[model samples]
Target: MDNIGKRIKHIRKINNMIQTEFAGLIGIGQGTLSEIEQGKLKPSIDTLYELSKHFQIDLNWLVMGAFECMNLKEYEYELLRKTRELDLDCQNEVAEFIEFK
Candidate 1:
């Protein structure tokens, strides 16, 4: 599976969300979510944020693979803004660096 796919699956499982249920919460078709989880397609930035909101995860972590899993606040309106500021692809590399250090 691609990085995006793994991230999606990881977050979903971490949150205890089933694919079908999570897809509903994210307002996407389960088939599409499944494809994304399977690494068949890339999600747009908007979609990424939506999933982050649904999962209450750090947007930057979700997109770039930076933090393994950010514990985002339920009502943090600015979380998305902070998440967008992070450079794309920073999450995965950051996670690795954190692990190595």
Candidate 2:
């Protein structure tokens, strides 16, 4: 489990996504993702890029286990996603509330 594949699998698990869903989001087949997770194959650069971009994964940590996999937990990511959908004024209010708390 000390490889890129394992790390990617970890990301998927923490996000509560199954292989089919995770692979679909990354534009890869389930079989390919399975092989990668099993450490029988390495992920391509494009896949790596997608993983980092879509899941907010840290590339350095994904490739080298150099740091934390993600700076935010799943709940925090969900909160941020929801915040981004709010109107600007509401967003500001939410930020202010969080800061005050």
Candidate 3:
């Protein structure tokens, strides 16, 4: 685990993609990919952006090796979790009981 390279390798392996396949998907040759993974070459910002685009991940996560991939607020998470717990059987009754009357 050598920081960026390690994270890249970790993510790649987690996704079940070989270095060659990941490299090809990201538009880099296997040799260049090897160099990057070995820390022989730091990826340029543009390259990082391209990699982010390729993986649909934030460039900051790729560059800084940030552990969090999502930024869900605690309240948002709780609200969503609570919303899912509402019984569907009572949904229509609940909806019809508006307080306006």
What are the Cα lDDT values of the candidates? 0.69, 0.84, 0.65
- Using TM-score as the measure, the top candidate is 2
lDDT of 2 at 69: 51
Q: Which ten residues in a row have the lowest lDDT in candidate 2?
A: 66-75
| Superposition-based RMSD of candidate 2 using all C-alpha atoms, in angstroms | 4.4
TM-score of 3: 0.58
> In model 2, how many backbone clashes occur?
0
Tell me the tens digit of each residue's lDDT in model 3 across 1-101: 33677656755765689889988888778888788887888766766776767655555657764434456553543344344547786654555664444
Q: Is candidate 2 or candidate 3 better by lDDT?
A: 2
Residues 22-78 of candidate 1: C-alpha lDDT, one tens digit per residue: 888877789988998888987777778788676566666566665433444433423
Best by lDDT: 2
Question: Model 2 lDDT vs. the true structure?
Answer: 0.84
Cα displacement (Å) at residue 9, model 3: 1.0
lDDT of 1 at 95: 58
Model 1 spans with C-alpha error above 4 angstroms? 68-101
